[model samples]
Target: MATDTDFIHRVGDLAPALRSGGQRLHRPLLLLWALAQAVNGKPRQQPWSAIRASVTPLLATYAAAPGDQAAVYPFWALRNSNLWEVEGSEELSLTSDGRRPTLSVLNERDPLAGLLAEDHDLLRREPSVAARTASSVLLRFFPDVMVDLARDLDLTTLLAGGIDGALRPRVGEPYANRTAIAAVYGGNGVGGITPLADGILSVYSDDKGPYDDRRVAGMDWIAYTGDGLAGDQKMSGGNRSMSTYRAEQRPLRYWHKPHGGVFTFETWVVIVQCRQRWGVGQNREPRREYVWILAPVPSPLRATWPEEVKEALAQDVADDLKVHDDLDVDLPPVALGDPQGAMTDMERYRKLSAAARRTAAGRTDRSKLTKVERYVRSTAARQAVILRSGGRCENPTCLGHPTELTDKGDPLLEVDHVHELSRGGGDTPESMIALCPNCHTLKTRGSGRQQLRQALLVRAKALHRSFAGSQGEDEKRREPTTGQPL
Candidate 1:
């Protein structure tokens, strides 16, 4: 007849070994002990059947001998030393009287409950402890396994494949931001992690993947460490004064790329010369200092030949500069007052300026006709008359719309004479019609004026015929055509 105290200690010692083998007998024993204690005052036998049923399956396969099987009874007895009634037994189906004690309740009453509560509190506070512990154990024992996984995957190829998969199905889809992928992972910090320049880092969402190849360069580690100016005090007998001046001069050059993106092998050479400096004393003379060149290796993994590579690149730039200098020496300056040449250039510029003004004015002019008179001249007024006569353009084949023919909804129509204005054709509505930008360019091309005028006349005649035909079918007679008044 072993005492309950001795049995509890023995069962407690075996608990860890059994748990290591993945057996779960202790929880059910504890639950049964709690239930028995809850019904202590009432005349009721323990619910042995329910407790046995709950825990039997868990221990049955592991208990190989009859002696091992008998260990369950003492285990149940020791755990039930203290228990309390559960408020929600009906939902749990643990008791017919609608009351039962749970292991949670028994633990609260047990003398060692404070230690158990503290352990539970610690586990709750740091849930990641279990996962971190497991990972540490695995890594300590199995370094080779992790290396094999790394070898099986080519990270760059996998990332590119993911990007291609996302874009292939949505061909021709307009990207709102073309630089989004580059901005996220192209060697810049993402979260709180400082971006490392010698390694590759990437992120993969369910729908997209972005990555960057970071390379260590000389410029990344360089720093400016010297100061140029210092303050000094001078004493002459009892009189003292302070003066500030620069000393031990050295030219400083700070190198930076205009666009921060991946730099290739040939792109890292930058040359700078100090143009000007201030803060030197009045007596001290200013002079141009040394020219500086900065070059960085594009890849961290490769060794750099900094001196040789920088010299080669600088010589190439010097050669290009020499070629430009030689060309400037041979060109002659234009003589002043070359009226014939000046007039030719002015005429060319005037035509270009006129075209530019027409484009700027658009299709409409709503400026007070006063402003129109000031800026809109002979060719523009002629164009306006043509737009008003045709509504759009008389050319049936023309695609120009009334709204498309104006700047700010003011008409941009330009008139073309059926016969040249210089050759006796009057500037009247009948002789001119509207033309859009495309047609106007065609009419003004070399030797095409006569053909363009004929084309416009044909379109105008067709339009008139259509209008006349529609009017003839109506019951009321139409108004007569008003020819231009002299």
Candidate 2:
């Protein structure tokens, strides 16, 4: 429904409204430089020096006099016209008059952020759009001067998509464009481009950039304490209590990278919503859904969670879920929470036997156990250990394969702690062992339990070695044997 005229008017209407000065060529020239950068495949934002270098030649050829031109003036003040936006400016010290900062301040702070990504896309998709915008600026402000300068810079073809039908440096003379863009792709600076085929790994060489490659299963699991380290903000659902902060669409900031010794950078994202889903028996367990909606706001800016609450109805999306987590319910219901009045006859006997495990030592202080303790006993970890063990008891001394599958289609095996919790053992995967009822009873109650424990430890270590050695091996070659009972 939109036409090219709408685009031209949008670009042309951004004339600055300076309080005292007459019309100036700064905004148009800045726009032209930005357009040129887009044509040449440069980043959206150019450094101030790049802007100065790129536009200086044009200004020198068209200025009224020798001392009447400055790049910083337009770069800093163009934001007033809504034609430009700058960040890293708040860090700069402002003058008393509250006017635009001096060139020195701008240079020191280097707040010359680039235009919006959408505008860059517009210029790229329709070179004629930029050409028309430039023509409008010249016709409106400096008809006479622009006439001569336009011709000298080959503006006719440049604005009209040139001989090759693109607004770029002439064919086979790529460096013919602006000096700053030349300096960038020409590989003259530290922030220059590198080819991946060279086998040199650099952050700049990576096409996905830093943030896009790092994916978390759920945003709710991520903690943004405003700290810079991933270890400082560990990813765990148990550690997070989202009840205090109701899930809603809101601004969220996450640590990016180290900017300096004292502070770090952050990427902003919107917490679209907090979602909850129940599996077959997941009602006893809580899990948060992490779905990223295409953000309605701009990127690389800080967004905060809203304190005020608003009600909104939920709508269904058709996209397939990429990842889903369901608690491992194959173990005895005791490992999960006790299901009131639902204990099977076999489970009742197991619970009575487990009660016999109680020594003079008091019951485990469950309240005092950290989330790390809970994670050791988590459904994910339990499933991982069992599946890796291949649906059989892991004791090395005896053969006790699962005779049947649980209701969840998992092998029926008892989960045993390699070291008893009362004996000061932590509930880690390495410390947890899967066993059949016979092996579990023998290891938990029979004589030579310490010897059996030693044998299970050896088998567990062998499994780890097999999994580790799986790298570079064929799938069939890497397949693990069905575990044996102790």
Candidate 3:
């Protein structure tokens, strides 16, 4: 008996015998048909003759090319996907390919075949699972004709919402430390928001940071402060990175710190709303910052998000979450900043470097050039790189990578130099960029180091210019210059 996880795992990862690529939908179509049938109370196992007659015409008309209704293979070969079973299999002779027998022998035998009982039972009990699975399959394989296919399969009720991956987090558990959290949700380990390889952030927060971030005493909402410390936070940088997750339909990996010990992975949260609140600057000047209101959710399956919270947040927007006054000392505003922020970390570094180039000089020692240079050993460039990354690695060609934690217990997104410092590369932001351990390894020691370095240089320059092209220009015209003091 396969468990729910097992059924879900197998169906999602089906390795159909795709040696014949002519009809790509054979196995998936067959599985969808079976799952829909399960929801409709169809018998789990049925005779092959009946199965053939039922699905042949549909496959021919809907899924297959002309005169290519090869329905026999899925019935026999689908067992290879581990979601089906053939009755009286002990007496059957197999083909040389070890997948299925000739269609003629199957016609004579008239064997019973269908979804395994355990799978069928689970599908019947949890129709949403069936719907979610069928919905995913249709979207993945038959997107163009999905609506018609769903109607044909009678999968309307079972598929109320599509199921993607669940937001990965063992909620309500104490993480050994923040580093463990970074390892789970890939990102740079330092900030409240970690950028995933997919260009989104996993926002981490606790009282540990400068901002007054915390959980509402009894509510499942987090009062998160947007990234920035002075001069009225702008809708740029980390704040912009975290705020867009809601519209992107992404879930946030929100981590909370309690006294900075054994960090707890608070929950998977959605950006409910953000409001401008008053805050204090490093120099005790009055400033406004973005405070994001995050509502906890069970998963990324949007259908499961708490509706009441949505209603409350929407209502809160109508009523306006009050701004926190700087003088209050205890109170602050809940700020939600820009869809795109004032400037990215890379931009900030460039501006800082440009401002200081007269006093500061680029490295001129070309005696010991190597493929990659060590970290600049400074926080200004490193912070800018990590903040710009928003926790994800910055390499454009990095299709995906493992989330590793650094010695500082942050996502081990190594702050490595794109150009060799030993060979006169400036130990500067333009010369340095954040990379995941895998990409860092490849850049440092891989055979294609030269090509990778050149590519990385392009990526670094692009990232550096990201903000100036949009927000920097905007900042020059409309916003004030605000960041850590030089």
**Of the candidates shown, which would achieve the greatest TM-score relative to the real structure?**
3
TM-score of 2: 0.30
Clashes of each: 18, 3, 22
What is the lDDT of every predicted structure here? 0.29, 0.43, 0.61
- Cα deviation at 481, candidate 2, in Å, is 99
**What lDDT score goes with residue 115 in model 1?**
12
Ranking by TM-score: 3, 2, 1
Question: Backbone clash tally for model 1?
Answer: 18
**Candidate 1 local lDDT, 1-486, one digit each (tens):** 333223222222322223443334443334322222222222222343443443354334323213323334433333343221222333333235534434443334322211122222332343332222222221222222322321232222222322222111122222223234224223233321111121111111111111111111112222111121122111211111000000001111121211233211122222211111111121222211111122233321112335544453445355442211111111111111222344432233233223323333332432222122222223322322432343465555555553363322333445565555444443333344566666666666737766766777555444333433442123113222354211
> For each candidate, what TM-score against the reference?
0.18, 0.30, 0.40
Poorest 10 consecutive residues of model 1 by lDDT?
A: 239-248
In the range 328-419, model 3's lDDT, one tens digit per residue, is: 22122111121225643444545444432322244343211111011111334554566556667888778556356533245558777687
- Clashes, model 3: 22
Candidate 2 lDDT over residue span 101-206, tens digit each: 7767766766666666667777767766667555545534454455465565446555554222221211123222223332422211222111111111111111
Better of 2 and 3 by TM-score: 3
Question: Candidate 1 lDDT (Cα, whole model)?
Answer: 0.29
What lDDT is reached at residue 425 by model 1? 40
